[model samples]
Target: MLDFSFGAVAMGHLVACVFFLKFWSRTRDELFAVFAAAFALFALEQVLIAWAGLPKEEQTWFYLLRLLAFLLIIAAVLRKNRRWS
Candidate 1:
């Protein structure tokens, strides 16, 4: 059973993801694309957590999803900076 809080958070992430996607479409910025991907991953992670009825994210493999999202953001930043330099 998905909790209200989790559902709300997931929805928020999805909305942000869409906004980022729109920005990416307008500017064609890789950073915006990466951000959108991260947000979507976050939403997926939350839904998976709720559906699986997981107790703690840290204790489960689901944590990897969040880690991957953060890593993607970091990689995007690094790549962008490298391109600028």
Candidate 2:
């Protein structure tokens, strides 16, 4: 169901944020901050997506948020990889 996907993504993003924060604390690296920002956006995107009662026009912004958030996550990962190597 759509509800399930939204919930799952929200939860997953939360978990990822927590994990990244822990890693950040241990490593004291700035890369984690990038991930944190990305995950935070991801959480926002999911919240917007879940509000099914919203107008179609509003939902369009949510979709854009989701796309940008998704790209940020990927950019964070790539940046982290480069930092590590």
What's the residue-level lDDT of 5 in candidate 2?
A: 86
- Once fitted onto the true fold, the runs of candidate 1 whose alpha carbons sit more than 4 angstroms away are 57-59
The C-alpha RMSD in Å for every predicted model, in order, reads: 1.9, 3.2
Give lDDT: candidate 1, residue 47.
86
Q: What's model 2's lDDT at 7?
A: 84
lDDT of 1 by residue, 1-85 (tens): 3477889999999999999999999999999999999999999988888788756744379879999999999999999999999
Model 2 clash count equals 0
Candidate 2 residue runs with Cα over 4 Å from true position:
55-58, 67-85
Question: Tens-digit lDDT track for model 2 on 1-85?
Answer: 8767888898898888888889889988877876877787787788767866676677877777767877877887788788889
How much does candidate 1 score in TM-score?
0.91
Instruction: Say which candidate scores most in TM-score.
Output: 1
- Best-performing candidate as measured by lDDT: 1
Per-prediction TM-score, please? 0.91, 0.67
